[model samples]
Target: MGLQVNIIKKLPGFELRVDFKADNDILGFLGASGSGKSMTLSCIAGIVTPDSGKIILNGRVLFDSENKINIPVRERKVGFLFQNYALFPNMTVEQNIGFGLLKSISKVERIDKIKKKILDLQLNGMEKRYPYQLSGGQQQRVALARALVVDPEILLLDEPFSALDEHLRNSMILQLKDDLMGFKGTSIFVTHNMEEAYQLCNNIIIIAGGSIDAIGFKDAIFNSPPTLCAAKLTGCKNISKAKKIESNIIEAIDWGCKITFNYEVEDSIADIGIRAHYLEIMVDDEDVNTFNCWVVFTSETLFRTKVYLKFSEPIGDEKDFDILWDTSKEEWDLVKDKPLPLKIRINPEKVIQINRN
Candidate 1:
């Protein structure tokens, strides 16, 4: 079973018009806060109604504006794992997992089902613990078990690991991956973290300004972002204005260099985007477009080193540009002593240029 949404909605300051589809796949809803990610989830879960359009899931009509058909939230049979890990404070973990089955299943069957789910989540010994007695990760696992105990047709997770610290978040994400592999059901996950989206999702839908900014596989969406907004949201740190001189000739005002790309820009107005990871400090023998730059500042991360570069002349608003380069301990030892001038190159094909609408 999968999810489909072709919907339009209007609020005081936002307008949402999105059309998307997914198979029995893990679909990610990615956007910054207030970008309609959660609102879309609510609409799917029947907590919010759209002004018009239809929501079809698993060959069933969840909401249809034309037919004036809408299923109540309780009847949707959709599992929603909320961001807050909404477990009952008074109930133990097992009781919480077995709550929905109270009237439907026999007491013995209910206990068996709940115990099976607890074991699936590796929470075997924590069944008697209350919500307050568990850690954040444990509480989230219990919430997930409760959602799945009903054997929901589709699963919806909203920022599932946002509350955890970095280490715990990574661990939970891996656990969730394992659980999903074992469960093998359709899921829609909403998150704002790009790394999370890349790591967890099979497909990505970026919502910006209440509309679907872009949608596709992780590589397709990130490799060739359809718009400036999509490129920015995907962490394309360097976006510069460029004027096309001819089919492959363009002049970048920020870099003050007229270069010919190996690829063609078919648009009249283009915003060139370069991801920080694709750029590097220029070496002496580099044949690419070499620019003279002075290191303004530097910071090291676990994965890469962030170097801020200042051009010989001011380059518009981006006078200081950030370049991320992978470094080893030996390289760090050699380069960390003093400020050094740098050179960087960007692959032309990697330089995505989005045309303004």
Candidate 2:
């Protein structure tokens, strides 16, 4: 079954306006902190009330402001996995998983249900363990099992791996994806991370300034962002104020360079965005769209080096560069000893036109 939400929430200093539908897909809410990501989930789960909105899940009216129908949280049939996992420290894993079952269930039936979930989630040996005794991943699985045992019509997760370490976060993402695959209802995953959202969600909704800036398939939103906020949220590192120079050319005000595109430049395009990994290293600066750049500095990750570059001509910030080029660590090692004035190029087809909308 699908879920539909069109809601407006008014907080002290922030207002959230979002409207979207999920056709039983893993819908991702991608936004920075305090961007109303968690609040939206709360509203849908009946944990928080919206000032005015309508929420229908699996053809049931969970909330409707005009109709004055606000279903109770327990009756909404929505499963919520909190950021902290929120496992019961006093209760054992088996008790936690079975806690959501209906009160009318027989004791023996409940025990069998919990045992099946323990086997499915691979928590059999740790059934009697307390929350503190389990690892972060195991705790997460217990929380997930607890949420799913109720057979909710929709599942809402708010940064489920926020507390895990880096290695655990990676593995937990894979686990979460696999676990969600078995869920037959609509699932919503909220996070500030673009990579994690793209990896776990088939459809993504970019939240900005308390509103949905963009919503579509994961690839479409990443490939062509409609607004500047959408571009930045999707991990586009290089976005510049653009001035249309000609039908096929536009000047990137922040990068201090003119780029000639193969396609006609639309007037509604107010900015341009380029993914860091899409940039290319150039042998010389004479090629089209190629420019001489000063390698300001570099930051290293586990296997990649993010190079900060500035144009030879100062048009943007003098102290901070506006362009970033991500290269492999092996490639950076070969050029770390080289001199300044490193050349780089931007492919015209790879450039994303950010519209005013």
Candidate 3:
């Protein structure tokens, strides 16, 4: 019914340590590059071995260092869609799709399954095309079809859509969602893109420096990340060192301001964060959680603009930019017409309190 992993593997700089259980759900391993997300997948797929601890899938011991039970890759029943797609260079699309089928099945049955997978994955006319003849997105689809045709007990996808164009990526995502909906076993999706993780997974595990930073339901984790690393990985752009000055207020040390929160501030509040979009550019200051901010700079994109504002006196350093306020281009146009030293408001409910700086 689930996959349980409690494994530790030593990497060059740090130990890859993690422990989590995921039910029959699409669980995302979210992290930055070189954060051991891919290594974790390789361990679960039996391509890499952990130094210690155990990995059990559906009550079966896949890897147990103490018991000396490390299942072979083919016997682990894992469908791994590697980052590179890993298509056979010499094999045609249909042959690659049929490579994983059981030899015990009749030749007719195998052909039927292969044909079905090819059609399902939209490789109808390119069945005889070789891997070198196909595009990146097409090769990715072929590899995915091959993995899915075998109907393995578990699925591991490492940045499955990293090679596709945006439109095709979205299309493949819908297709993958359909495939996962019918799949009954556990699926682990590894990705550094926060948006992809949010869109595809029911739950997410944030990894940083080869350590498990946070793990929980996707919405709960996004709404409230407990640690500083988790908050930053979840795209909280504005963060500052903080000290609780009152029951419901804290001083933003780096930003040179005091922020009030609706919830009681805890003594362990070492950092505070607010998403850039949560910041509001106001013409006048509010009674609470509002301060006069001087604009340091503005960076504009086609659709949006990032405005950096300093809330307090200049710290007289070259690296002294305070809060980042992200707004739409149209909204920036509206705000830029105002005078200097504009009032900025911090929505208390949107403030994220972090236990670690």
Candidate 4:
């Protein structure tokens, strides 16, 4: 079964208008802060109401404005894991997990259900601990246990891993992935982290300016972003204004260079994007897009070295535009002793054409 959403809601300064559908696979809502990713999840979970449109899950109508149907939050059968875990401070882990179960169920049955959840989340001995007494990972597991105990039709996560430190975040991510494997419901993960989205989601929806910019399988969207915003959000560092000059050539006005594309150049292409890692240091000017550049700045991390460079040939009266290039530490070591006035090659095949409209 799949989830379908086509909704609109107006806020004081922003309006959210999104429409997409997802199957039982994990779907990601990838966006920047305040871009409506969490709001979309809230609408799905019945935490927030859309001014208009419909939401359907597995053929069940969750919200329909025209038909005047709005399911109550409790009856929606959707589980939500908030950014802060949202666990009761005073409640024991056992009581928190069993909170959603019906009161009519016998005490023994409820205890059995809670026991199973504790075992599944590896929270067996911590069942009586309070939220504050447990570690970050344990608290997260308790939240997940609470959400999953009721067997929701849809699971919604809003920046669920944002509060953890690096080590704990990675560990919890793996644990969450394992726990989600046996889940029989559609899962929606909302996040601004590109790496997390790519790692956890089977499909991704890129939201920008309170609207969906693009939605597709993870690899397709990352490899070939359809819009300039999409490219930026996906971490494309080198982008320039482009104008089509010929069937296979486009001039990047900002970079003061012309790119020859093997694919047909579209008139609608308003920009060109190139990933930082795609720019290769030129040992010799043998490539078609090879150009002379000056190193403006350099920075290095443990794994990779970052170089910022500007085109040697400046555009008329305009400030020089810089482009970022990243090389692995291994590659950087070989060229660390290279002379000044660096020359770089732009891989024509790796260049991405973007249509802003």
Cα lDDT of all candidates, in order?
0.80, 0.90, 0.88, 0.89
Compared to the true structure, candidate 2 yields what TM-score?
0.95
- For model 1, state the Cα shift of residue 320 in Å: 4.7
RMSD of candidates 1 onward, in order:
2.8, 2.0, 2.0, 2.2
Checking candidate 1 for backbone clashes, the offending pairs are 282-343
lDDT of 3 by residue, 84-109 (tens): 89888989999999887778999999
Question: How many steric clashes between backbone atoms does each model show?
Answer: 1, 0, 0, 0
Candidate 3 local accuracy as lDDT? Answer: 0.88
Using TM-score as the yardstick, the better of models 3 and 4 is 4
How many clashing pairs in candidate 3? 0
Candidate 2 lDDT by residue in tens digits, 17-99 = 99999988899999999999999999999989999989999889999999999999989998889999888789999999988
Candidate 4, 129: how far from true, in Å?
0.9
Model 2 spans with C-alpha error above 4 angstroms:
313-318
How far in Å is the alpha carbon of 38 misplaced in model 1?
0.8
> Candidate 1 on 85-181: residue-level lDDT in tens?
8889999999988876648668888888999999999999998999999999999999999889888778899999889999999999999888888
| Model 3: lDDT of residue 281 | 73
Candidate 3 Cα errors over 4 Å, as ranges: 313-319
Candidate 4, 1-357: lDDT as tens digits? 789999999999999999999999999999999999998999988889999999999999999999999999888998889999999998999999988887788989898889999999999889778998999999999999999988899999999999999999998889999999999889999999988999899999999988999999999889999888889889999999999999989898889888887888888879998999999887787677888887666789979998778887445655445788899989878876787667788888898888647
